[model samples]
Target: MPIIRLMLVFLVFKSVLSGVYGNNSNSENDSKVLQMLIDCGGSVTSLRNELQDMKDKLERLRSEAATDTYIRWGRSSCPSGATTVYDGFAAGSYYTHSGAAANHICLSKKPKFNYHYSNPYKSSYIYGAEYQTYESIWNNLHNHDVPCAVCHIPRSSVIMIPGTDDCPENFKEEYRGYLMSGHHSHTAATEFVCVDGHPVTAPYSSKTDKDGTMFYFVRAKCGSLKCLPYEEGKQITCAVCSYSP
Candidate 1:
């Protein structure tokens, strides 16, 4: 449409020039007019190509901005249709340690180190995480080393809702699982995280309470949290959701 409009305007200008010059125009003026028309046509072709290039760039930017990434705790693989960035073992600070990070980390299986720093004095440590959900819905996973994966979803945003197993309206559910955190009685408090419902353990990991870091299911207390929607002494559930737009 832009090119068509440009052509119409150019045609009207040409008609005006033709009327002004009539048959009394010199050969030099006619040659100049021909060159001017050629230049206008070239400008229109160049502008069209630039416009197409700009459209292509916008499409690429939208695609690049659409992705969202998160860690899939207690599972070594991502949900169907999601891409795995890296698969690793879940790790965190010692349960009794008070001077370390309060958050968990997914340590890559194949690590690349620039240089090793060997410290003789006591230093903060992160250890392999284990499931402590005994006598509960995740009893089967008790004492098993937890595995984790970094997943990338082709969506604009991702969120972890701790109180419900279902995603909110207009969002796609990436996974649903139990809300887990450190033991309430532990000296060091930790942030809660969502673990996959059907979790996978690390390969060749033994079923023992090594207890470097522990994962315990979180329970709700209805006094301040309200009883109609939440039940006392009931394990909380969680859902990971991905949203587009």
Candidate 2:
């Protein structure tokens, strides 16, 4: 009887060991499956993020391409029989009038404008003599009362015509009209029609006066004008012009 009992105990122990080994094998297989799933999920997430970034870049490129139109014309494109009156670079500076109680710049003598001078209000003005180079204007600006100035290269001719609201003949708008700031505390003027005898205008007609103020014309259309960097206060004006082909 004792011998029979020992054989039965040994059989029971072997059966328990076999069950434990089977459970461990199943657990190992389950762990491998879970790891694979995790890796695949991470890859999918990374791919989605990359695709979104690519889409954003493509959209920005398209928007820039649509509005980046600037036609560059040389001196040869002037109208026939046109007498070039002022054909050099021009610079203007804004300053506070000593007793006039206004902030403006006077360019009457520099370009020799015969018309009644319209003093447009501005915060800062370019210093030094007229028609200064960028470097010279920059240097003079530092020593002046206001540290900001506007410079331009103007080409204009004296062709008399009835004053009309339209842009001058033989000229085309180069850039969409927009307000340009001196990047300072004061706003600059935006309504001056002729710079160094050149017929020019802000493509879109509007006014603003604020720090860091700006606007861009959409679709080369005049009506879609909007202000930027804040919408309140007076705005300084800047002009963009090009010779007509």
Best by TM-score: 1
lDDT (Cα, tens digit) per residue for candidate 1, span 1-245: 35676566656766777789775666676567666766877887899999999999998898677898999998888999899999999999989988868999999999876556655466778898999978987788899999999999878679999999998888899999999999989877688999998888886688988998899989997787999788889889999998854
Clashes of 1: 0
Give the residue spans of candidate 1 off by over 4 A. Answer: 1-61, 114-116, 120-122
Model 1 residue 67 CA deviation (Å) reads: 1.3
Runs of candidate 2 with Cα error greater than 4 angstroms are: 1-25, 68-245
lDDT of 2 by residue, 1-245 (tens): 24464446444544564577654545555555445555666787799999999999997775444321221111112233222332222223332222222222322223554466457565533432121112421232221121111322233222212122134556544322223212232344322222212222222212222112111111121233344432434222233443442
TM-score of 2: 0.21
Instruction: Tell me the lDDT of candidate 1.
Output: 0.86
Q: TM-scores of all models?
A: 0.73, 0.21
Model 2 Cα shift for residue 208 (angstroms): 31
